[model samples]
Target: VGGAWFAGDCAALSECYSAGSQYSAAPILPDPLVLPTVQHLRESWDDYQDAVEDDPEVGEDGFIFDFAPDELHKANISGATHEIEMVQYVADPVIHGVTGRSGITLVEYLRVSISWGGMPGWSFKPDQAPAALAALRVRPDF
Candidate 1:
């Protein structure tokens, strides 16, 4: 994974790294994945929200989470640099037929999640709620 240089309360870190091989000469893929399980996603979201709404020391994007090495190997493929934000919903997916288990499944699957703490502090003010709401307008026609 490439390094992430962060500023203020928001920071993006190198979750993992992978290198492509030429022909048959190749090296083991580095940091195969940045898989944050569903539980991890929930916890990270809760923590980031709490940091924004409660923790004074928590600067913008101050909360950082990464993938466990084994989880990365198991889930991450192609050595792609997956931002934690992009895979936070992996936690909502089921881990059946992979964990040596059966008949277990999870719901509410997604690919990415926005972090509350990543927002600039000024944007979270009471007076900005209306404008913020307006800016969130999503046009499905596109």
Candidate 2:
């Protein structure tokens, strides 16, 4: 149920979504959850591309050398069932092993399941989720 999506050669809306799910296993959520998740990813990708386009410093290769986490969009969705949450964030290329260039911004989407009764509750460490999730890279079409 966990995987990474890379938008390596995605350059269009359809391509972007295709790439987003290419590396991941088939989603288990119903359409209600899946549709919105896709929308969020698409919007985030668009925002990232817009930021890159607006940056005067972007190189001919379409990479922003001075990228920052805040420059990328941040969003979250709480499932209707209230048992899952999806989070999207900008991932650091160096940490994620996406590319050698520090300016290449990668986005990561994570699906976390909530548990109500346990010492740790969640399967993954909340504090360390960012680092762990950031390692998952999605290559959005630019």
Candidate 3:
């Protein structure tokens, strides 16, 4: 597995590095037999969306209920110099099936940036450039 550097403001962070960030990796399945299951999951998600849209209490505000506002706020805090974002298996989908089912997982690492807090407040010193550059060489496409 590999990691990347994601820079910019909260909007960019939300669009590229946040929880609902898009995954560009191709699908991985050990066998073609899992197609039905995959289809079912997709259909189930569509149905779930419909159900939410029809529900008065949950979908009345016109937005699908997902993460809590506070949680999202914490995840997208401005001026947060050090933070970690989990890159799920979907981002780099490769799975080995031992049985009929496979479990999804994720890789996480701390993303340290001086862009938000400015250089004076940055904990990452000049000496750490080589290490930081080595660690974050691959910037994924959004």
Indicate which candidate wins on TM-score: 1
Cα-based RMSD of candidate 3:
17.4
Candidate 1: residue 68 Cα off by (Å) = 5.5
- Candidate with best lDDT: 1
TM-score of 3: 0.20
Candidate 3, residues 22-113, lDDT tens digits: the string is: 32331211110111134444564576668777775654443221211111222243311211122232363322221222331112111112
Q: Positional deviation of 51 in candidate 1, in angstroms?
A: 1.7
Query: Rank order by lDDT, top first?
Result: 1, 3, 2
> What C-alpha lDDT does candidate 2 achieve relative to the native structure?
0.26
Q: What local lDDT does model 3 show for residue 86?
A: 21
For model 2, the superposed segments whose C-alpha errors exceed 4 Å read 1-36, 56-142
> Which model, 1 or 2, shows the larger lDDT?
1
Q: Give the TM-score of candidate 2.
A: 0.22
Candidate models: Cα lDDT each: 0.31, 0.26, 0.28
For candidate 1, report its TM-score.
Answer: 0.25
Residue 73 lDDT in candidate 2: 14
TM-scores of the candidates are 0.25, 0.22, 0.20
Mind giving the per-residue lDDT tens digits that candidate 2 earns over 31-110? 11111244544565576578767884543344322221110111112212111111233342321211122332232212
